[model samples]
Target: MSRKLLKLKGAFDLRPWYQRNDYLGWIMRAKRDATKVRRLQQMLDELRAGDAYMNMAWRPRR
Candidate 1:
């Protein structure tokens, strides 16, 4: 069986095995997006914690 090599932008080309495998691309993209989502969630949690602390600190004592 003959397979065409996919030319990559940098230097190396995609091997026949990778060229034939379709899910690898989707999995890579999903993993990247998942990482981004995790980072965003952590930042959001930090911001919320800071906001709550500021609110408590600004309250006047009776």
Candidate 2:
């Protein structure tokens, strides 16, 4: 009976494994999107500065 109790205790004492790769994957995707947004903003700023009418050109003409 004591052996069975020891086995149970050993099972209960086991710690949960940490998921470092899952967290690292999320961080990498976030960094990628942030870089993409910065590049897009820079392009928009350049377009606006180069020509004021360029903003209107982006609108759909009907």
Candidate 3:
């Protein structure tokens, strides 16, 4: 489900390289499976919505 959303939006590709790495590293640092899942879900939601990043409003360049 997450992969589909990411792929559909080219989410990872569209973001700055450092942002992408930060997101993945943040998720990986989660000590609990639940936390990891929660972060991943949040990432997907932000990507699919096309309006936010890291829980903050973000409008992509046109």
Candidate 4:
């Protein structure tokens, strides 16, 4: 009887230098946009809720 040997394949280093740079740039831009979007959404929600304290403080008395 002969036994067959099995070999395991190793994982590939997926990104080269150029691709890594491109991905890093994309990630940074995405983070910045996400922060801005979150801030804007919070402001919109506050406005919709009619947060009286915020409105009274920001608005000038006539």
Candidate 5:
């Protein structure tokens, strides 16, 4: 979990464990600098929004 994202009202913790784990592995697997940055940005955006994961619609646990 990102310290910055963690500061956002448990945004990282809000995600499913599988999503978090898989995203880390997927993001770290990027071979290009731009790809890593893009994936990371997408992750941050998704986490911040709390309404989507990997560009797919998602509803948080209520």
Candidate 6:
């Protein structure tokens, strides 16, 4: 897998990027598990709501 880097401000922990990613990956594996659907959506929402630092973190370096 390609490395995913996350740039966090001094206010944030470095763990969330990996934790959230791992959780999302786990959710994908349970394609037919209805119990996790809501959780998956919640996580997706978190990712979408990420701040400016996160947005820049994922962008390709110029």
Clashes of each: 0, 0, 0, 0, 0, 0
Candidate 1, superposed: residue stretches over 4 Å from native: 1-31, 51-62
Stronger candidate by TM-score (3 vs 6):
3
TM-score of 3: 0.80
For candidate 2, what is the lDDT? 0.40
TM-score quality measure for candidate 4: 0.34
**Shift in Å, residue 15, candidate 3:** 1.0
Task: Flag regions of model 5 displaced more than 4 Å.
Answer: 1-5
Give all TM-scores, in the order shown: 0.32, 0.32, 0.80, 0.34, 0.81, 0.35
lDDT of 5 by residue, 1-62 (tens): 76774565488776789988988998999999899999999988888788888989999778
Q: Please tell me which predicted candidate would have the highest TM-score against the true structure.
A: 5
**How would you encode candidate 3's per-residue C-alpha lDDT over 1-62 as one tens digit per residue?**
67686584687689878778878998999999999999988887887787888998988888
Q: Residue by residue across 1-62, what tens digits does model 1's lDDT show?
A: 22212222111222234422432443345457786566445433433343222123322124
lDDT for residue 23 in candidate 6, whole number 0-100:
63
Clashing pairs in 5: none
Please give the CA lDDT of all the candidate structures: 0.34, 0.40, 0.84, 0.36, 0.84, 0.49
Q: Model 2 segments beyond 4 Å from truth?
A: 1-31, 51-62
Per-residue lDDT, model 6, residue 45, is: 49
Off by over 4 Å in 6: 1-17, 21-32, 51-62
Cα lDDT tens digits for candidate 2, 1-62: 68755664443233122322432343455557886566445434533343222133332223
- The residue-by-residue lDDT of candidate 6 on 1-62, one tens digit each, is 22222332221243356665676576777757684786566554444545423224442123
* Cα shift from native, residue 22, model 3 (Å): 1.5
